[model samples]
Target: MGAATAAALVLSGCSSPYDGAASTDGRSPGAPGTAAPSRPAVTPTATAHPPNDAVGRQMSWMLGQMNTDPVSSDVSSRFTEQFQAEVPPAQWLVMLGQLRAQAPWVLESVTSDGKAGSASVVAQGRRYSLTMTVDDAGRIDGALLKEGAQGETATTWPQVEQRAQLAAPQVSILAATVGDDGSLEVVHRSGEQGVRPIASMFKLYVLAAVAEQVRDGALSWDQQLRLTAQDKTLPSGTLQERPDGTAVTVREAADLMIRISDNTATDLLMRAVGEDTVRAAAARAGATHPEGITPFLTPRQMFWLGYGDAPQALDARAKWAAADAQTRAQLLEQVPMPGPGPENIDMTSTPWRSGVGWFATPQEVVQAHLYLDTLAGDAALAPLREILTKNGGIAVPDWSEQAFKGGSDSGVIALSFLAPPPQGTQRRQALVMIGTGERPVDEETFVAATADAARLLSEHR
Candidate 1:
């Protein structure tokens, strides 16, 4: 609530010659770059500096607002702009309270001197630095924070190695790697390796399943088919309302399912592949929850199925033995589906039907990519990657060589990429990010998280 409490006790010792301890014209020190004389005084300026009162109150209000929940982008941006335009001189406590309250789930510690300050915040389960400086007033003069590490924390051999071994939150990255020998590899999860629902990421498996049929002569990408009522299941990809009674090729369906994430197209492909086959393929690829289509069942369907079969389907469950009820429910319910068939189809309509909603660890995600790559080589991986790497309607050039898949269900977000390293680069990287919380999943956060993770892996390679 006060600057003294927010700042570290005994803040005076942390100083340097450039820290400005004197004043000019025989007055006590007041501003930067002034060679003023020093004087022992009891009362300092109540406001910090520059645009003092306005800035302090603004920060105070920002900190107060954060007690409700994490600050939304709109809230953060508004405060950021206002604070910058009208900064305070000595409102360091306001900064501490604001950062801590705004990201309570992430921030760890905060400390400040009159000049420079630092705070520790957790992101993706790893600690990161947020450093800033204050002018004579308590407004932020400068600030710096990165999604990754600043430097090694330890000087000792084992400590340094251990620090190096630590994984950032973004390490859940999934990607494809091309080696020096032209061989492709995938690296999925980097830390706390655990199995997570792939959601739409499982669509890659559906794509691979279809590709397998193509390789075995059971199906052809160019083959055409009718959009029957049976194909109107929930979560169906591009198989939505196409020209009614119009015909389209299997390749086109695959393209829309992978590229546009079309739900109806996904449903048709699923029916073609059969739920059993898709589950089998997913299991072979090490998917932990291979119930596949079952996870996308409606609540009533889940009730009828006893909720024990596809634990990932229902968005809420009161299990006799478990704590991840919300997560399990989110994993199950968030999957997309299409409308029911015309034969009295009464179940909840899924946005993307033929798609997969199975749970897989980030490693399983990489393995899924590998399974597909092994079958049709780069060709099968291409279309999906093109759409996913676009980062939501915007094209990114570096992603041209990247073939990947992305999935989102409620609070869960997943991405699996298989791409060539930039020209002349050898090692490949897999980046996966899985977020399961009550917080709304923003697409920009996903893209930024993935990009940051990929950059981290690239730097080490």
Candidate 2:
């Protein structure tokens, strides 16, 4: 319910949104696709491709094939039969047409790790990020297309804001140069300082609370914690499936919580640090809405609040609305919330916009990252850096010392990053905070837009 998929941090490329956040290889593409029956059938042989511009040529070739009827060779000549089986040539063209993607696709560049690769391409005025799987014979296997980067010889801050709004009707984006003293010098921003739902990104505060505990000697990273049935929340992580008594270290839980958006791990930390502790951490991180996060709703409460017991005698919707912060705390402790089971859950609903999650301003999120950045670099808080750097979300490896925490629910998505600014900028860090909601943010389009934003921040000097 927090993040939709496992978020794998691809060192030099983008991982599939389906990949788990902690896994290094979960983003690997499946075996090459098979040919559609209409095409001239030929076996796709594996060919070794060294890290070179050859990947760009192959991407260009594949893009060139999209304009044809029945996709010359029905794309059988270019892709494996297995790959073609799911998406035939006609459907491919139709999907591209929906995006209004123009033809004569030009390959901007490709990053290959020998086995998998990410290609950036431009056509007309639109940019695309493609995760292409090339078999050993250099045959195409599987591909995931990310849409939304604007087509421009160069991107400007204004256009970045324009593209951000396209991703969500309600959007907030603010980029800043972080000072060593923890102040933010605003560089670019589009939205007001309004508090907005931040979905699982709230886990960052929970993480901060955990780090605070470690620093105060109340908690230790290597300290063992056990997961009970009551502690389990829902997925966007695998921890929910473990046995009730499963034991994990504080560091291990924090890793899963950040890397995979582990709801269970988040709740465990909240338990360890207490909601009051997290509230203090949130205040320190510059949260805009103190009331919204004071109790720090867990995924279980979020899911329950999201799917309120409308028809039942214990209507959480009405009672929760009338309750004060103190009463809300009581409700959390006394109210019967949903468990990990699938029954009675309505994930299809849009509870995020109703503010059932973390609340922060785009600027405040930058503050949050700044605070985290400081902790990450500290000797006592070293685990914080490793946890955050584990998944740098929308990959743009050019950004030095990239650390990220992004969150999403049905109708909300937040992407925040902290890293050193471009050379000669003389800034401690380049911070990006974006939040979009009111409807489900398109993962592909939003991801592309984010990548473009990071790429443009390089010119911040």
Tell me, by lDDT, which candidate is best.
2
Winner by TM-score: 2
Local lDDT at 449 for model 1? 47
Scanning candidate 2 in windows of ten residues, the lowest lDDT window is: 1-10
Clash tally, candidates in order? 64, 18
Query: What is the C-alpha lDDT profile of model 2 across 1-461, one tens digit per residue?
Result: 10101011121233443122111112121111111011122221222222455455556565555434234545566666766666676755555453333454555656776557776654444454567676777767766654323323227777766665555556677777777687777777777567777777787788888888898899999998999887787645668789998988999999988887777888777887887899899888777678677568877667666665544314544466456778766665665554653345443456654445667777777777778877777688987887887775655555765777777665455677887666676775554445455444544445556667777776677
Off by over 4 Å in 2: 1-130, 134-154, 308-314, 318-323, 330-335, 341-348
Q: Where does candidate 1 stray beyond 4 Å?
A: 1-192, 233-238, 284-357, 378-399
Per-candidate TM vs. native?
A: 0.48, 0.71
lDDT of 1 by residue, 1-461 (tens): 32221221111212111000000001111111111111122221122222224333333343344334343334323333444444332343354453453343234555555466555544323333445554554544455442323234443333322332232222243344656443436433344456554556666667777777776778877777777664654322335556555686777777766655555677677777776676666666556654433443322222222222233333233331132434444544443333242222212222122232355677677767656656554564344444334333213344445555665433344555665454446565555555443322332234444555555445444
CA-lDDT, candidates in order = 0.44, 0.62
